[model samples]
Target: MKNKFSEESIDFIKDHINDDPAEIMLQSRKFPELPMRDIVVQIASRQKAKNKLPEWFGNYELILPPKQNLEQASSEITAKFKARFVEGDSLVDLTGGTGVDTCYLSRKMGSTVYVEPSEELCAVSKHNFEVLGANIEVQNSTAEEILNHNLVQSDWIFIDPSRRDNAENRVYALEDCVPNVIVLEERLLNSAKNVLIKASPMLDIKKTLQQFSSCYKVQIVAVDNEVRELLLYLRKDNDEEADIEAWNISDKREEELFSFKYSYEESCGFDIEEPQKYLYEPNAALMKAGAYKLIASKFGIQKLHPNTHLYTSDELIESFPGKKLVIKEVLSPAKKEIKKRVKNGTANVIVRNFPMGANEIKKKIGLKDGGEEFMIFCETEAVGLRAIWCERV
Candidate 1:
């Protein structure tokens, strides 16, 4: 770890804890004896941690990693979500950068080991883990070195490969990532009974499954309707059709979860109909999972069009894993007709399976953004195109 902060520097940081980091740097000339750079980094990291890692933000003694490492670290919410999959006496984190995941995953296991290639990060993590009272062993080594040397064995192994290449350019493919999970798949499966690999949210799920034959499950996780991470679970000797699950974690409402098999979605059938009393839109997680046909089949709802993902029904399905809106009136896509129904001249506009974009339709219809009202533009099988006026249920 870097040298301990002097007593004078600590006092300065406490006095200006809430000050802007840029402003502090501007006034650094006043404190010639204090470590302004370190103090500013701590204050700035604390600001980011207020929401990302509330528990760590509350602890003053714990040291935060550098900005880049913190950016790559998983938030407390996602780390806790990963902890639910821990089901063994021993766990090993092969690419423990900031140790956010290692700290949480260690809570469920009797023995845990954290391995990292960067000595600086390993030192910071070892210090922080000690301060947090987490019972984890820190190993300053790469995943390949650990595996080749047979240094440790665990029932479960969790790895989140670095997404950036040597040039600091982001890469999403399984083979392009650091340590290349594809090349180490056989060794990983042999090392542990179950292996959990965290991949980029932008990764193509179908393509990734084709790369790993042992993978039996894929999880697409979203927070408050925004997709965040894609997780792949592999078993030692299983090769069944992978089960895909979409999980949306939200603070406003309960979690929305939908799971399906690839074969089932391909064979499922859905009904196409015109607008009804209520309309439903799938969340980001479900959309990323491609649960279009199975969602309608499972919920007993009708699709607006074969290509459109929006659904409708005569009655509200309170349990639907998406937004539920009540259709007030269906207006023609004419400016005059829209003006008649939307007197307020402002609405939350959404477009799907339509030729025009949201901004284009908004400008053409002369409407501003934001309001309790929603305007849904789409192409339906029954009608060529229409604007749906709705209110949140």
Candidate 2:
């Protein structure tokens, strides 16, 4: 690992901010002493961080990891979201990948410890945290080793296990993840009053709750419309049903929070009816929470089908937490009918629980995939699968 950063190498990286890595490598033939791969990786890492980690990306002195590691790091927005849950004097972050979560969350606590296995990453995190004016203790040790060693009891323990295994295999189960938060959940709770875990967005929430019954709250956080991470907050004595929160962060307005208990969603009843004037689709965070029925019942909207997870209402609900479309026509997915409706030969196609996928339907209907027109293909209790044509609101 390239842990040492020299003045000349830093200058070279700054000079070729926009240069292609291949071209830089070819040009590196002249200067064999410089670390070409490290410099190129820094440039690529900063480029990726531009959109995801704006604060670090804009700073020239901050050292960043490779693109893959940078991708694993949490965005400043998501980190701040996790920070809000932490209220304590001390926090110990085990498996601190890039220290993004540690840096943002440490601001709330007086004493924070960041534990990382990679020596190079620990060095980089120390430098970046220093540059950002955060006073966090960086430790170059594995989580297991630290927990087994002279570990002090902290108020909160945050662990974000590596999603990839030693063989670089992708793992989804909590037990499969590095440090195995599921196996160590009870141990962590013993060390701290609360244990907060940052899990993969793809990790099943229901399965996680089943594994860690002590979870008091499960937060599915999304930025704009994309689901990013699933944060699980666990306490030692949480025996009741956990509260589920779906948070969609937006810059235009305050964070849209849709909270409901899992039992409430399971026990809720929804109405199924024909397409109405307005059709609503739940946001990614809501979908991740599996609060399908609760959303429909709470919004007073009718569901297209039990499995469709799409809602419709006669009156426009301006405060809906997702995409709202005005229905223009509801027709069968017949090729002739679709062709007749899409005279412009271009439309945005969406397929859900339909026999023919979006691409197949697009090809069969002979329409290019670009337009203001929206073609929704979904199943209904009354009709198996039909196409609802609409305009985005």
Candidate 3:
């Protein structure tokens, strides 16, 4: 059933808004006339949107979808990031579940179409778009059906396929997703000059590139040190190698970006050195972009190891894309050595490419986790395993 909020229900929701949603749900019996489930969903969704989508969350009339759609939907930050790549008279977003991307991207074009197969979601999106002052047409149709309808050509087309199956199990292969983009690639290219595809950040880039004959660029996006989404830009006639963009959209006001060519990363060689005066860890976006060697060569920094992504430089580079820290000391992972190196028997622990996990390492070394001091465990070609102790700069 479509979610509709009455004046009384809306008032009740506002009155009982609490930080503890589960505790509030116990009082659902008080409002039997209202869709208590949907009300709770709205309260929870708006609470999350307050931090994740501040712009849309501020509107009193803003409507939200169920928990599943809200969970899968893009944040305002990433939605606007995708919008910057498109500018034209018209664009169409296929597989527009909650229309989060469609809403933000539509602001860039003169005319836009939001097509979704779910009538309930389309209705909610239409109402919210009206509240946001976005002029757009909403269509209820599958991506494949719309592409085959002899539709009018548009400047750009967007697709974000459902990554889950009927049983709610996750699927990562392009062919496995609903309205499979890989199967409809030819039709999509024929329908527009540019096609933008969004996929799970966990999807392998190199393997995905092998699916298409050519691509314009691949954008690896992350927020607050967690990888979020991978955006693929496709052009019908473009035969050039794909350029990679690594964006750390951690801050709402500013973002850090690094771009590189895949060929440069493949052909170039990098130098590896022992622990230097400072250590640099590439952001989640750059690490997912797989530009390990390029980061070292382009920034004139030395890599600790070919396998380890951590970088080192004698001179400090504050503009580095990721976390930077002063190297206090390098020691062995042995319990005796760690106990002697760490002061106060406490520090923050991070384990990467190591056999032991953070908790296990902490326990083995007789240290508690949490302090200004940081301990990192990683593998190196010179040394099989080593521990780096430092403080954030």
Q: All models: lDDT?
A: 0.89, 0.87, 0.86
Model 3, residue 199: C-alpha shift (Å)? 0.3
Residue 95 miss distance in model 2 (angstroms): 0.7
> Model 1, 327: alpha-carbon shift in Å?
0.3
Tens-digit per-residue lDDT, 217-289, candidate 3: 9999998778889999998988888999999985543688999888999998899998889999999999999
How many pairs of residues collide in each model?
A: 0, 0, 0
Q: Could you tell me every candidate's TM-score relative to the true structure? A: 0.95, 0.94, 0.94
Candidate 1's residue-wise lDDT over 1-393, tens digit each?
352566676677668778899999999889888778888887887777878898988876777876667876888988999899887899999999989999999999998999998888888888889888999999999999988887767899999999989998988887899888999998898899899999999999998988888989999999999988999999877869999999999666799999999899999999999999999999999999998999999999999999999999998999999889999998888899888888889889999899999999889989888878899999999987989999999
Write the residue-wise lDDT of candidate 2 on 286-373 in tens digits. 9889899988888899999888988999999888898889999999888899889889888888877777788888788887878788
**lDDT for model 2:** 0.87
Q: Give the runs in model 1 whose Cα sits over 4 Å from its true position.
A: 1-11
Lowest lDDT 10-mer window, candidate 2? 143-152
- Candidate 2: list runs displaced more than 4 Å: 1-8, 252-254
Candidate 3 clashes: the total is 0
Cα displacement (Å) at residue 40, model 3: 2.4
Better of 1 and 3 by lDDT: 1
| Candidate 1 Cα deviation (angstroms), residue 309 | 0.4
C-alpha positional error of residue 233 in candidate 3 after TM-score superposition, expressed in Å: 0.4
Clashing pairs in 1: none
